[model samples]
Target: MSDTFDPDHLRAELLPLSTLQAPSEEAQAYQRFYGLNALGPNGATSSRIGRVEVGGYDIVTQLWVPDQPVGTLVLMHGFYDHVGLYRHVIDWALGLGLAVIACDLPGHG
Candidate 1:
């Protein structure tokens, strides 16, 4: 893992981040930094990462579903934020039996 919290280090560790997969250490560091898979829920009945066209722009998207979701949460991060930064919220919704669908803002992520 990188010694510092480099945003580049956090990039491209998996699908929807980069076309090429990176080392697990890098990916784990990102998860740890965000307190995911540790400080929050991590399990999901189903998870998907891909891209979609939104308003004539291609955007990276991710979806998480619980065993039997009662509703869905369309999460949006703050300014300059990407979908990965909100796993806690996503997991929270999943734990509450709700599906989550988040995407990188146009030209952001």
Candidate 2:
């Protein structure tokens, strides 16, 4: 890959993540900048980050699950926030054996 934004390739890789998989190299770069992997809070049974088109708008989404999750939690961020900013929250929910799904606000992060 080059130093460019390759949406097609990313979609090809990300679209298959039903429950989530390892991050691609390009994704790792962005993840670092976004603190997606901060503090080693990666105890999820599976996790995924992807984009979805809803009402013709692109939104970044993340899902994290723990083993034997008792329930699910849909997290939301404030204005100008992204999913990466809530890693701790994700970790907390996962620690409580809850699956978490969150998305970035439009045109932010």
Candidate 3:
């Protein structure tokens, strides 16, 4: 991890925006700071990103699978939290050979 990791930058990227349009600049900053793409490489595993429609809204989802999985671990972010904030936990889980599945809650993050 780089010493320049900024929590503010990550928080800005994770903020819920009123507009539906994507902010390319913030997204780029997030990629650079976190060393992870929206749905690309993550440490030793490549993650899969998708969305599931429940009720009348779309919920973002992410899955990280190791080469040889021993079990599955579900990660749920707390209030005002996002998946990016749980990278360390995810890394730890991956190291333990546990596949991780995380999702953005209904209206949080």
Candidate 4:
């Protein structure tokens, strides 16, 4: 496919976190499915969810660490993809004692 599109404009149009309204029920359900609520007491050593400012946009980020981490793995998603789709990967990595850090790209889940 050949096309010309500018994501900069869309990124610029994003509102600040403070100015955004609360998430809807559907959004909440998705979050729950993705384990975005909080780290469960039964799983990995640690996990956290937060946001980072990038070029005037807030990008969602997450980290999962094993009790005895052998190394860190940065999990990146492709276009139109999100971390939720990699739960199995995360589980496997954690099983192998690898820490995982992931994020939701701009304009994606």
Write one digit per residue (lDDT tens) for candidate 3, span 1-109. 3324444453444433323444345544544455444331345665554555568766666677887778999999899998878877887888888888887787754
Q: Pick the candidate with the highest TM-score.
A: 2
The C-alpha local distance difference test score for the whole of candidate 3 amounts to 0.63
Question: Residue 72's C-alpha lDDT in candidate 1?
Answer: 92
Per-residue lDDT of model 2, residues 6-90, tens digit only = 5456545664335456777766565556555442234445667777777886666777677688999899889877676787787
Is candidate 1 or 3 superior in TM-score?
Answer: 3
Off by over 4 Å in 1: 1-44
lDDT of 4: 0.64
> Cα deviation of 95 in candidate 1 (Å)?
0.9
Over the stretch 1-109, how does candidate 4's per-residue lDDT look in tens digits?
1122233442344443334345434444544676543332356456555566888868866677778788988998998888888887777777788888887888786
Please write out the lDDT profile of model 1 over residues 1-109, one tens digit for every residue. Answer: 5533454444443445234333356555544565443321455455554556668866666566777779999988878887667766776777788877877787676
lDDT of each: 0.61, 0.67, 0.63, 0.64
Using TM-score as the yardstick, the better of models 2 and 4 is 2
For model 4, where is the 10-residue window of minimal lDDT? 1-10
TM-score of each: 0.62, 0.71, 0.62, 0.64
Alpha-carbon shift of residue 104 in model 2 (angstroms): 0.7
Q: Show model 3 residue runs off by greater than 4 Å.
A: 1-42
**What is the Cα-based lDDT of residue 20 in candidate 4?**
38
